[model samples]
Target: MSELGIEYQTVLGLPPVEFVHLAADLDCHHISMKVTGGGIYHHPAFSMLDDTALRQQFIAALRDRDVTISLGEGFVVRPAYELRDEAAALDVMAELGVTRVNTVTMDPDLPRSFDQFAIFTEMASDRGMTTTMEFAKSLTVTDLPTALQAVAHVGRPDFALLVDTMHAARSGNGPDDLLMLEPEWVGYIQLSDDTLAQRNPVYRDDSSDRRVPGAGEMPLVEMIAALPPVPVIGVEAPMRSLLAADTPVSECARQAVAGAREVLQAADELRETRARGCHR
Candidate 1:
C-alpha cells in the first residue's frame, strides 16, 4: 500500500490508544496524534496529561505493533492565543518518540506570524523535533509559495512545509506549484479528496466531508507524482458522512487506506509506462 500512513482526523473521535491499535491493524506504519481538539489545547484524554498508566500502556502498544507517532497535529499560532505548555507537550512527544509537530497559522500579520513560527520552530528543534507548517487557503499562510517563504524566513533546518492534497486543490495549487517546491522543504504530504460541492463551503464541511483518495475528483495521481520522492503520505479523509451512518472507525480507515493505495499504484504504473515509452 505504498507504506502510506493514516492521520488521526481520518478516524476522529477514536481515542489515542485505540487509534494506535487501529493503525496497526490497518498495517499503517505511522500514526498522527492530536493533542488538541475543539479549540481546546491539550484535551486530557489525548494530551500529555493523560494518566501515566494509560500513557505507558500506549507506549507498550506502539512498541508491540512497531508503529511510529509520525506527526502531532495541533494549533493555530497567533499573538492573541496563549501558547500552550509546550514543555509538557514536548515531554509527551519525547515519551512517544515523536519527531515532528504540525503547526497552522491563522494570524494575518505576516511579520508577527513569521516571528512566532520561528520561535516555535526553534523550541521544537531544541527538543529534537521538527516543526511543519500546514497551509490552507482559509489561513494566513495560504498556498505553497507563502508557506515556503515562511519556512525560509524561519531559516531553521527543523522547519518544513506540509502539503495536504485537498487543501492544495482548494487553494488552486496545481501539480506545477508542487513541482516548484524543493524536496527538503516538504515535511510530508496529506492525501484526501473532496467534491466540487464541498469546495464552496470548505470551512463548514472540511472536517467531515473529505473523501478517500481516488474517490473524488482531485488530481491525486499528478499531485502524488509531483511531490518529493519517498515523502511520507498521510491519509486524512475524515468522512463524517460515513461516521454519521454508524460506520466503524476501522472500516473508514480501511477504506481510506485502500483508496490511497489504489491511487499510488496507478501513479506508479503510469510513471513506469512513461519511462518505458521514453526509452523505446
Candidate 2:
C-alpha cells in the first residue's frame, strides 16, 4: 500500500509547526497544505514580498522536509479571483519545483464558467503542476459522472478529479463511482470517514460526521480497490473530530496512521475476495 498523508485542516487545530512535526513523527510521507487566496504567500512565516520570493520560500519549505503539497479545497468559488491568485501561485510553484495541486469549487449547483477553470488549468500545465478538482457533494461536479464530464470538457492535463473521502461517502459514491473515473482523471485521493452514524441520516451532515478513514462508515476498502494507481492518500478528517475528545496531535496522527492501515488492509481483503468469487 502507498504511504498516507494528512490535510492541513485535519490536525486538531494545531499550528503548522506542531502539525508538520506530528506528521513527520507519525511517519507520514506527505502533507496536503492549502495555499488559497493569499494564505501561504502573504503569511509572516512564508512572507514573500513579491511573486519571486513567494515561490522561492514555498519551495524551500517543501524541500526542507522533502514533502509534497496538495493544495486547494475551496478555491474555485470565484474562479476569476482564484485564478488570478493561482497565476501568482503557479509562478512560485514553477520556480520552486512543485508538481501538483488539489482544489475544490464552491458552486456545486451550476455548470462551471470554464473561463476561470480553463485559465488556471492552462497556467498549472504551463508551470508543470497538475491541478485536480475535488468533488464535493455540493459542487456542480457533484458525482463521478458529472466530474468526469467536466474533466472531459476542459480536456486539460491539469484539469482532473481529486476525490475526497468525505464527499464520496456523503454522496453515497460506491465502487461504481471509482469505475466511472478514467484512470488519468484521478489525481489524488483524500480519505476520511462518515462513520459517526452507522445508518446514514436523511441529511448526512458532513461537518459533524467526518472521521479518520477506517473509523467512519465510508466504503473505503471497496473504493480503494477500484481506484487507479494513485500517488497520495490524504487523511482529512474534520477538525472537531480530532478534538472532539480532546485528542492530542500525536494521538490524532497515530489514529490517522491506524485508520489508513485499516482501509488499505480492507481493500486488499476485498480484492482477494472478489478474485476468488470471479474464479468460482
Candidate 3:
C-alpha cells in the first residue's frame, strides 16, 4: 500500500510548527507543504525559511512527530516570476531534507516555459532534489500531455509529472489515461474526488473544492490501481463548504483520511484480484 500523506491544502493556513503537529496528531507520517514563498491559498505567515526561530521549532516538531514532508510545493513558474529567486529557499528546503519539489507552470509561452522549467530543474537538481511539474486548466500547460511534454522538454531524469487527480478529471483525462503514463514520468499523485459534471464553471476554482475520496463520482480506485509505484500519495480534498461552515480542521482532515483509507484499501484489493486473474 502507498503511504498516505496530507498536503498543505488539506488544512490551509496552519503555521509550520502547527502543521507538523497536526500531522502527528492524525498519525500521518508524510505531508506536502510550501517550505518558502507564499502565494494563492498559501499561508500568509513567514515560513521556516524566513524565520530562524520558527525554523528550529518546525524542525523540532517534525523530529518529535517522526513526520517528513512528502512533497515541497510553492514553486510557480510564470512570465513575471523569476525562478532564480527561489534558489535560497530551495537550499533551505534541501537542508531540511526535502527531496521532491512541486512546480506549477503558468507561462503561456511553451519555449519560454520549458526554459524556465529547465532553470528551475537545474537549481532543484543541483540541490539533489527531484522535481515534479503539474498543470491545470487555468495554467498554460493545461493538460496531462502538455505537462508530460514539459517534463520531456526538460529531459532530466529528476524531472517528472505531478498528477493532481482533480486536475486530471477536469482536464478530460481518465483512469485509462493514467495507465498509459510512463512509470519514469510518474511523480506522486495529489488525490481527491470530484463529480463528472463540473462543479465550478471556472477551471482553476474547481480544483480547490473536491469531494472526500470515494464520496464522489471520481474513479479513484481505478486511478489508484493504475498508478505506477509512487513514493507517496497526498490527500488534498479541500472542501470549501466545510471551511465556510466554520468546521474544525481536524474534523475535515479526519473525514478525508477515512475516505482515503477506504478507497486505498479497495484499490489494493482490486490490484490483488487483477494479479490473481493474470496468473490464471
Question: Per-residue lDDT tens digits of candidate 3, residues 1-280?
Answer: 9989998887856677777888788878899877653343445666667688877887788888999988888888878788999998898788677889988877777788888888998999899899898877788888888888888789989999888787787788888988898899987788888786776778657766778899998888998888886878999988767777877767888889889989888988999999999999
lDDT of each: 0.78, 0.64, 0.83
Candidate 1 lDDT, 1-280, residue by residue in tens: 3468899788766767777889989889898886544221222344445567767887888899889988877756876764454667666776788889888878888888888888777777777898888988778988777887898899987888888888888788988788777878888788888864444355745646678889898899988777776446889998877877878778989999999989888877767776799899
User: The CA-based lDDT of model 2 is what?
Assistant: 0.64
Off by over 4 Å in 1: 36-45, 82-84, 196-204, 275-280
Compare candidates 1 and 2 on TM-score and give the better one.
1
Candidate 2 Cα outliers beyond 4 Å, as residue runs = 36-61, 70-74, 79-82, 195-205, 241-244, 272-280
User: Against the true structure, what is each candidate's TM-score?
Assistant: 0.90, 0.79, 0.94
- Of 1 and 3, the candidate ahead on lDDT is 3
Best by lDDT: 3
How high a TM-score does candidate 2 get? 0.79
Pairs of residues at least 3 apart in sequence or in different chains that clash in candidate 2: 72-103, 108-139, 108-140, 195-216, 195-217
Model 1 lowest lDDT segment of ten: 36-45
